[model samples]
Target: MADDRHQTPASGPAPNTPDVVELPDVTRRDLVARLMKIGAVSLAMALAGGGAVTTLTTAIAAESTKSERKYRYGMVIDTRRCVGCEACVVACKQENKTPPGVYYTVVLENGFGERPDDRPLFLTKPCFHCEHPPCVPVCPVGATFKRKQDGIVVVDYDRCIGCRYCLVACPYQARYSDFGENYPAIEHDTPWADVPSPEYKQFRQRAEGKSPIGNARKCTFCLHLQDENGRYDQAAGRWPACAKTCTGKAIHFGDLNDPDSEVSRLLRERQAIRLKEELGTEPNVYYLV
Candidate 1:
């Protein structure tokens, strides 16, 4: 029996010259497959990151625009039309239910004194709500401050410690210490005693030794009358009691920023003057002398 078998080839490629080896043929399909394996996920992640950045930028821009729409809410009192009636004062008391020594507004009877003209001059004075408020920084506690949304100086009865520093710091005499004195009706425990004051929208009932009693009190420009957007509706009577009840039509309240508003028109038409502008307080309250 003969054994027929294939013999092994022992000779290999030359070591001196590099052997040329054939590789698999590559095509566009191969490139596409490779891209799908790695580049696809990278592209998707990039698109998602770009979308998130766009959304975040849009939201921040909207918030910045809203914050810039700050309102310098203030008053323009036409002194020429004021008749010294003090209706505004009485109306303020009725609205805020201010106690003794806690007058939110007052009329300067001889503010202008005897002028050359025969007409008597009476200036209605309220919390000026100065741009650089003196009372805010003077507060030992953070009891009083001005709102950035609306330039209305506010006193936090909860935070006040009866220090009265804010009262002294106010150059406009806008602040006062509430000593908890009440009217005869409250002292007698009559039906009016239960009446609640709608200050800062707190609606707190009058009581002795309470928060506001020991706190610094001042005019808030009747801020409680404003809407959520800090707007006052004159037609609907949702306005400051003083301005609403002014028989002389002297008090004009509106956003000073709005050129279309009546207060803006008045300020443009007339020469307005503020009390103690030299003090650098920059009072929002203006008087048409």
Candidate 2:
């Protein structure tokens, strides 16, 4: 008998030949949704065949009934109250123990005009944690994500490949790439070098070739201070270091979703503005100009 594997019938083309099929153009969001659906179906079949029907059903039910948003954590800064003292900047450095040139928050000064008589506007800027964060989708490794519980955008340093895609995607220039630069205290092997940063509830000591050393970093709203319920207690001193330490009490942080919350109330009464609103990033951080 002749081997059939290599044999081709008298036809227009080979049997195993693939035909080019033109697919419809899909937007990124549609592509992602389709991929998620494919994954979910695959997982469901695997679990069902493995006699884990209950688990699969429960998971599907939970996903189907997932809430749109539990909280919208944000900040409202009163520019009038800001003294440009940079106390918030200092507090953030001390709290996060960030390396030199890797500040999660910064104070920017803008003059009203080129004239000397123009008054300078002080802006304390941090990660906006946008409702539709461009940074999250651009990260190829899925290292950065917006938390479903509180809407805080965070980075998973372990998964980050340091591609810096998020940095470029961010309109606010909020994300920073860690180049492993250390402060003088850590560089000189001083006693302060032993202190670890309690970032993301991970007390990581600064060292060469570490996860955060090469990962993209950003502000997390001091989420590490939140309790297991994902709630910050200002009375317990569990608030964000920058907001807590603002010398002029310029920064207001709270759950914007709650209408009664301080941030929401401020938004209702004060004339607030967000940066680059035309981009439609929907930044959580608002400035009371």
Candidate 3:
């Protein structure tokens, strides 16, 4: 009999025989390219997910920081307690040593109503230290800015050009332009002239041509009296001069952000109003009607 292995089948293959298969040739470059494409797609997906996570984290942190502000120094003035006296004005001047015609605080009589029979409402007006201060953005030289730590609006006298732009921009008329005027006691060659002003802790003395003489000035909430941590010790007498000197205890100053602070309690207990609320200045100062 003939060998079965050498015999040829009439059909493609025998029923019990296995068939041989041929595959297309693959190169090293092709394998590498395919792997690289898969890797790139994975990396792109990972990066997109990572970027989204990072953005979410940043937004959360910003919101948390805004809600947790350390201090918001503000005041709550009781209109009933104010007696139309100008003691606060005098105290502010003495503490800051401001020049004539430049009062950091003022007492406005009959601010609420002008009826002759109606009782006069004496309002003690100071720099409101607005959350969105218009004077800060209009400064041509960036001399005025709001402090982030305590939300106090302050002026950099050294950077001021005495342009008076900030004065015009302020809706509250809180800014003043110093035109080199002096009082009799602080006149040149006088004893008070040699005395240094403790404003911003600079302790600058009056001179013929110097800073603060021609610079725009405003109230700083008497920050110079604050300690290094921006804290005011009421018992230690390190407090705002205007608030400390109010004879009737009309002015209540403290960290408004503190839930247990005096100003916060007054706001919760009494009906308070801020000046120019329509302008959206969001002033830190509030008046209890």
Candidate No. with top TM-score: 3
| Native RMSD of candidate 1 (Å) | 26.9
The model with the greater TM-score, 1 or 3, is: 3
**Which pairs clash inside model 3?**
none
lDDT of each: 0.74, 0.78, 0.77
Give the CA lDDT, 0 to 100, for residue 54 in model 3.
34
Ranking according to lDDT, highest score first: 2, 3, 1
Q: Could you give candidate 3's per-residue lDDT for residues 1-109 as a string of tens digits?
A: 1111323332333221212223235454443343344333333344444434333333333333334556889999999899988899999999998888899999999
Q: Give candidate 1's error at residue 267 in angstroms.
A: 0.9
User: TM-scores for all candidates?
Assistant: 0.76, 0.75, 0.76
Lowest summed lDDT across 10 adjacent residues in model 3 is found at 14-23
Flag clash pairs in model 2: none
Model 2: lowest-lDDT 10 consecutive positions: 1-10
Q: Model 1, 130-173: lDDT tens per residue?
A: 76688877766566777667767788687678888888888888
- For candidate 3, the lDDT comes to 0.77
Model 2, C-alpha of 228: deviation from truth (Å): 0.8
**lDDT of model 2 at position 185:** 91
